[model samples]
Target: MKLRVENFGPISYADVEIKPLTVLIGKNNAGKSMLAQLIFTLMTLTEGYIPRRFLTSMLQHIRTTEDFIAPYLRQVDDLRKKIKEAREITHLSCVKMVVDMIIEYLTQYLNKTLGDFLERYFAMELKSLVNLYSDYTRVECAYSKYSIAEFTITKDGNLSAKFDIKMMDELIDNILKDEETNKLINRVIRSRGGRDFTSTIAAIEKIAEFIFPKRPLLSTLYIPAGRAGLLEGYEAVSSALIALASTAPLKGISVPPIPGMAYEFYSLLLQLTGRKGPFEKMSDLFKEVIEGEIVFEELKLPKSKMVYRFKFKDKESSVDLIHAASMVKELSPIYLVLRELVDKGYLLIIEEPESHLHPAAQVKLMEIFAQLVNEGLEILITTHSDILLRKLAHLVMEGLTGGRANANLKPEDVAVYLLKPDEKGYVTREVNILEEMPTFDEVIEQLYEEERNLCYLSLQREMNEASPRNF
Candidate 1:
C-alpha cells in the first residue's frame, strides 16, 4: 500500500510505499512516528471490521411503500366512503377503476421512494471513506477495491440498479416494472422471505456482502515505547484500588477515559491480561530471546470480581513485570501480543523496539522480526539503532544464501525510509538496499572521520609529551 501525507504534524510532505517489513530510521522528532500513526489511523478507520448488527440495522430501516400496503388500502377505503357520501356511483366498474388508479399511484410513489433511499444510503456510505483525512493534512491510501450499489428510476417507470466495481458498471437495467418494483422493494424492505422476511434478508445480505465484503481489515497493533513505565505502575495502582474497594462496596466506580498514547498502551495491557491463547511457538521464541516468559495470574477479588497481574517467569521464580529487567518489561507487550493477539497478516507497529535493551538483544529482536515477516506478519518499526539495521541486513543476506530455515525475505520485501529535516520542514526518502544490504555510507563515513580525529589528537599529544617543554 502507498500512503501519501501532506502537511501532517512535523511532516511537510511524504509519500511512503509500505512493504511487508518496513523500517523508518531517523533522529528524534523527525516525523517517523507521525507517518506510522497516520498509517494506523487510516487503516483503523477505513478497513476495520464493522459489526454485522450495525449493517443489519441500517438495512432494516430501508423500507418501501409496498411494505405499508395495508395503510394505503385503508386510505383508499376512507376515500371511497367519502366519495360515496358526496355522490352515489351506481357502476361497480367505475369504483374498481378508481381503486386501481390509487394502487398504481401509490406503487409509483413507493418505487421512487425506495430508489431515493438506496441512492442516498450507498452514496453516504461511500462518502465516508473520504472523511478519514484531517483538516490540516491530506492522506490517501490505496487498497483492494469494492463495489458500491447505485439505484436509478428509469423513464419507463421501472427500477434500475448497478454495481460499480472498480469503475466497471454491471447494470441491471430496468429490472422491475412499476408494480413489480414495488413488490421487490417491499420484499427487500420487509425482509419477507422463506416465503417471509428472513430468507429475503439473507439473500440480500449475501449479495451485499459479496459486492462489499469486509475489506480484509488489517488489524494494527502498535506497541509504544512508554509501555515499560506504564506496566510498572499498572499493578500497584490496580492492587491498591482492589484492596480499597474490598473494605467497603464502592458505588459507580467507572473506568476513566485514557487519552492519546496512554489509551493505546492501556488497551494492549488489558488484552494481555485477558484470556491467553495457544501461541506456544511465539511464546517459546520470546523465552529463547529474552530468557523469560510473560506469565499472567488471575486474582479473585471480593464480589466475585477477577483481576489479572502480568509477571515475568524464569526457570526459578516469577517476578512482577515492573521489577523484571528493563528489557523484559519493554518487550513484554510485544511477547504478549504475538502470543495472543497478533496472527498471520496483521500489521504490528513498534516505536523504538530497541529501547532499554542491550545491543545483542536488539539484534536478536530484529532476527525475530525477520522470522515474523517470513511467516506472513507485516511489521513496521521506527528506530535509531544501527544494531537493528545491521541485523536486518545480515538476515536478508542469510536468507539469500539459504542458510536460514524457511526464512526468505528479499531486499524488495523490506522498505527502509530515512526521515530527515531540511529548510522546508521534514521529508522522507527511501534508502537503497543493494545485494541484500542497505547503504549507510554517509553514517559510516561520519563515524570513520570521528575516529580519525580522535587518533590524530592522541598522536599529537604523544609527540608533545616526548619533546622537552620549551619553558
Candidate 2:
C-alpha cells in the first residue's frame, strides 16, 4: 500500500509506501507521528458495522463449504465471455458493474470513517490537522494497483473524497466459481423477489460476499507516546470510566473523549485471552533480554477487571506495573502484545521503542523487532534513536551477508522514510537508509570542539593560580 499526501500537519508533501517493516524518522514536531496515525487509519478503515458484520458472517459460511467450487471455477470463464458480449451490446461489464456498486456503496461511509479517526485520535475538529497556510489537506491511497480513495479536508472542514475502479471484476467473478457457494449466492439474489425496504437491504447483505470476498482485514494496534504513563494509570482510569458509566443514564453524563490510540492501548491491556499466541518464542526472547516478565491476571469485578504485574526472572514476588522501573513501564506493553494480542499479519504501530532503555537494551530491542518481522508480524515505528536505526542497518547487513539468515531483516522487507525540513515545510521521502546510516558528524565535531575549548580554559586557570597570580 502507498499513501500520498499534501498539506497535512507539518508535512507539506509526502509519498510514503507501507512495507513490511516501515519506519518513520525525523526530528520532533516534524509530523512523523501524524503520518504514522494516518497509515493506521488506512489499515483499520471500515465502511460501517453492518457491512463489516455482513461480510464477515458471509465469509464465515463461505469458508466452511468445500463443494460447488469446481463449477464456480468453470463459471469464471463464462463471466469473461459475458464481459465480452456485454461490452459489445451495452458497452458495460457485469463484473465491473458489480464491483463498482460495491465500491460506491462502501465509499459513501468511508469519509466519515476517515473523519472519525482523525477527530478522535487527535482530539480535534476535522480541520485542525490541515496545514494552517494551505486551503486544502489531501491524501491519496492505493492498495497495490487498485486506487482506493483520494480525500481532501477543506479549510471549512468539509471532506471531499472519491475513488477509482480498476479491473476488479475478477474478484466478483471468482466468488461465483463454487457450487454450494453458488447456490447460496443464487438464493441471495432470487429469494428477495419483493419490493420491500428490508428485503432490499437483506439482499445487499447476502451478496456482499460476491463483491468483497476474502479481503484481508489488517489488524492494527497503535501504541502512542507516553505509553508508560498511560499503562501506569490505566487501572484507575478504567475503573473511573466504569463508575461514571454506571450512573450515566440517571445523571445524563458523558465520558470525555480519550485519544483513540490510547483508548486502543487500554483495550489491549484490559483484554484477557488464554489461547497461546504464535509470537511466544519472540516474546520469550524479549523476556530473556529484559530479564523480566509482565504477568496478567483477571479480577471477578465489574467488567472482569484486569491487573498486570511485573516480576523479575529470579524473583518470587511481582510488583504492579505502575511501580515497576520506568523502562519496564515503557516496554511491558510490547511483551503483552506479542504474548497475547497480535498474530501473523497483525500490524504493531509503535512510536519510539527506545524511550527509556540504555544502549544495550535499545540494541537488543531492535534485534527483537527484526526477529518479529522475520516471523511475519508487521511493524511501523517512528524513532529519533539513531542507535536503533544503526542497529536496524546492522541487522539488514547481517541478513545480506549471512545469505538471508534468521534473526535479521531483509532489505526488501524494510523501508526507511526520512522526514526532512525544507524551506516550505517538512516532506517525507523513502531513502536507502540501510546502505548508509545517518551520522550527525557536524554536530559531534562541534561538541568535541566545545569540550576542547572548555579544557583549555580550565588549564589556563590552573597555571595562573599555581604562578600565584590568583593568590
Candidate 3:
C-alpha cells in the first residue's frame, strides 16, 4: 500500500510505499511515529471480519430480498437479470456494487473508530495533528490504483474520512471469477425461486472477499517507544486490575495517559492463551538476541497469577521480567507478541526496535528482522540506529550476492524512508536501503576526513624532522 500524507502532525509531505520490511529513519520529533500510528489506525479501522459481521446483521435486519438487494440492483441490473434468468452469471459489475456497499458501511464505521483511535494514540491533542500553517491536512492509503482509506483535517479542526470504492476492483473481479465463487454464484442463481437465504449469504460472503482479501489481515499493531518502561508499568497495572477486579477505581486516580498502541499491547499481554499461534517458534530468535527467554508462567502456589519470567542461558533460575535487564525488558514484547498472537499476515509496527541494546545486539536484531521478513512476517520500524541501517544494507548486498538467502533481504523487500524536518515541517523521502546510510549532520563523515588529514600532517612532520638538511 502507498501511504500519502500532507500537513499531518509535524509532517509537511510524505508519500511512501510500504514494503515487507519498512524502516523510517529520522531525527527526534520528525513525525515518524505519527505517520506509523496513522497507518496503524487505518488498518485497525478495517480489522476483524468486517464482511461477516455486517452481512450477518444485514441478513437479520432485512425482511425481504428487496430490502437487501434493491440498494445494489441499480448498479448491477444486468448481473441481477442474468442471475434471475438462470444464465451464467459472469458479470464483473457485481464487484463494483459490492465494493461500493462495503465502502458505504466502512465510512460510517470509521467515523467513530478513527476518532477513538486518534484520541487514544494522540492523547487528545487533536489540534496538534493539523499543520498550523496549512489550511488542511490529508492522509491517504491507496491500494492498487485507488485509495481505500483517507482522512482529512481542516484548519478549523473538522475531521472527516472518505473510503473510496474504486479500490482493488480488478483484483476482486479476478476473485469473483474464481471457480469456487463461480460455483457459489451459480448455486445462488439456480435457487432464485424465493430468497434462498443460505445460498445468498454464501454468495455475498464470496463477494465480500473482494473487499477484504485473506492474505494480509486488516489488523495492524504498533510497538511504541520506551516499551521497556511501558511494559514494566503494564505488568504492575495488570496485577492491580486483577487484584481490584475492576478498573473503575483506577479511572478516578490521575495517571499519565498511555498511547493506544501501548494500551493495546498491555491488553494483549493479559490475553495469554494455551493454544499457540503459527509463529510461536519465532520466539527463539528473540531469546538469542536478548541472551535470555521471557516466558509467561502461571504460579498457583500463592495465588493464581500470570507472570513473565526472564531466564538466561547460563542461569539456573529465572526472575520476573520487571527485574530483568533493560534490554530484556525492551525485547520481551517482541517475543511474546510473535509467539502468542500474530501470524504471517499481521503487520507489526515497532517505534524503536533497537532501544536499550548494544551495537552488536542491534546488528543481530536487524538480521532477525530480515529473517522474519524472509519468513513471511511484515515489520515496520522507526530507528535512529546507523548500526541497524548499515546491517540492513549488508543484508541486501548479501541477498544480491546469493549468500545467506535464509536471512537475506532483497532490495525490493526492504524500503527505507528518510523523515526529517525541513524549513516548514518534516518531509519524508524514500531512501535506498542498499546504499550507504544517509546521515543528517554528516558529523561522522567530517570527523573521518579530519582524521585522515591529521594522519597526513603527522607523516609530513616526521619526514621533515628526519631530513636534517631540509630543516
Q: How do all models score by TM-score?
A: 0.65, 0.80, 0.83
Count of backbone clashes, every candidate in sequence: 5, 5, 0
Q: Would you list the C-alpha lDDT of every candidate in the order shown? A: 0.58, 0.71, 0.74
lDDT of 1 by residue, 127-178 (tens): 2212222234344444323333233333232453332334322311221223
Instruction: Estimate the lDDT of model 3.
Output: 0.74
Q: Candidate 2, residues 133-238: lDDT per residue as tens digits?
A: 7898999887545446778999888887776555565554554564544454344334332223233333344345443322334467788888789987787888
Which regions of candidate 1 deviate over 4 angstroms?
47-135, 145-218, 236-257, 298-314, 435-444, 468-471
CA shift of 385, model 1, Å:
1.1
Model 2: which ten-residue window has the lowest total lDDT? 64-73
Best by lDDT: 3
Error in Å for residue 435 of model 2: 4.4
What lDDT is reached at residue 94 by model 2? 35
Please identify which of the two predictions, 1 or 2, would achieve the higher TM-score against the true structure: 2
Which clashing pairs does model 3 show? none
Rank ordering of all candidates by TM-score, starting from the highest = 3, 2, 1
Q: How far is 170's C-alpha from truth in model 1 (Å)?
A: 11
Error of 1 at 328 (Å): 0.3
